[model samples]
Target: MLLMSRTDNAVQRFIFENTDIRGEVVSLNNSYLDALEAHEYPEVVRRFLGELVASAVLLSSTLKFEGLLTLQARGDGPLSLLMVECTDQKSFRAVAQFRDDIVEAPLQTLLGKASLLITVDPVKGKRYQGIVPLEKETLAASLEDYFAQSVQLQTRLWLACDGQSSSGLLLQALPASAELSADARSESWNRMTALAETVQSSELLDLDHETLLVRLFHEETVRIFEKEPVRFICTCSQERSAKIISTLDRKEVESIIEEDGQVAMDCQFCNHQYVFGKEDIDSIFNEKPQIH
Candidate 1:
């Protein structure tokens, strides 16, 4: 059997003509479910991961290089780690680890005293990582705080997820570009963000990007660019899994093979399994040099 999903999985970039502000709107449907299908997660955990993936897609526009952006939240509570990665090609993957016996709690309680790490890995330039304390009620608020403190940019984000789909909106205040006064730029940013704050989760999840933009910024001259699709994809394969086994001690690998007849491994992200017999292990070590 095949299932068809009708939601739009894409990102649209927008800017106002007379203002130094830009933003993005993203919606995820089947792609969101594809990211979650490899594992069985609780409802809260599923929604949290969905929001993370949506945010990653929205932020993927900031990557100027041919590398990737990773958002990681880690702590000691039931939800130990939630991570998502998106590349310049608009491909994304996400995974979450949580204790099963978690109680019903808010984001902070579920994550304990966690920190959110935003990392940008460029192909040619230096890598950048910024850490923000996770103290807010939602990931959107925490990310907005990150831009304010780390990048000194006025930014705002609204994120939402139903169990089946996810959506998000982002507004960033750019520097004065048209010889406009500093106060005017700030005012433009303020009024635009204030209007966006009135949006509801249902609106974000249900309405298309054009309809939602008209609803929020009918009075402003919003210019939306060509829409780009976003997809859920995992970058795991037999070669990479083999490389992992080749690095282990030869004796240890042999012992596992002796007992089980094959060394078995699985990728937690996509739940893909790889098994290496003794001959396969021998070739992995003897056939070629390691790829680092």
Candidate 2:
């Protein structure tokens, strides 16, 4: 049977009625392409970036604070770093840094001795960081392990990317309640996740959120909330770029301008260029002369 095209970059949250289980389904289209266009990434890097962006959006939806959630994977291999950031407003950006000669390979080979760092930087509260070993063959497995250990929630993630579009499904067991016994909650979680495990990668990438949810949980009573828009919003601007130059020593800034006539700053996440001419450099240094 044929499926309709998936919805635009958006996320949908759903909860099983009378059960302690919740889920989020996300599909990324233009947002994924926006980040991909920032750099000429290899196939393996593209695949991993897509999946990581999806996961970041899914995890960000679970946060209640007003700040940013970052997922960073660092290692000493061909793939050095894979970073994705999602803000509380449902916007996200992703970037990947790898060797120039990187090639598609197994996950472990690309990211040797890696660690996944999940950081929650609240706008008004203390920031928190969690480190999880990226020993699993797949990113989803490593995230699931992190949730199991930190949040104490049984979380399962299914992430898929075809080097173009990406999609993810997250199912998490809510806290045990007085009304729902542990045994009952376990049964519910098991049944729902088992049904979810039957989902195909193509379905996730092609089907709309509501269609996919109904197809998976038609038998179960699911209450889906309104869809939230996800956008590719980069936090880069000329003002921020100017601050970069103001932090450097006066001689260093002048040396760069003397050598190239101007200092060009490129935002790695969005590939936006911010050029500072002599006048602009003078203004920055004049405003912040403490930068000796």
**Evaluated with lDDT, which candidate comes out highest?**
2
Residues 1-292 of candidate 1: C-alpha lDDT, one tens digit per residue: 2323323999989998888899999999988899899989899998898999988888778556788899988988999999999999889999999998976677788999999999998887889999999999889988988998998888899999987999999998877785289888877888999999999999899888888898899999999999899999998889988888878888899898899999989988899999899999889878644754
lDDT of 1 at 37: 96
List the lowest-lDDT window of 10 residues for candidate 2.
174-183
Off by over 4 Å in 1: 1-7, 287-292
* lDDT, candidate 1, at 7: 37
> On residues 1-292, what C-alpha lDDT tens digit does candidate 2 reach at each position?
7776798999999999889888999999888998788788988899998999999999999878999999999999999999999999999888998988888897778999999999999989899999988999999999999998888789999999999999999998877762367788878888999999999999899999888988998999999999999999999888888877888888988999999999999998989999999999999989973421
For residue 203, model 1's alpha carbon misses the true position, in angstroms, by 0.3
In model 1, the Cα lDDT at residue 209 comes to 88
Worst 10 residues of 1 by lDDT: 1-10
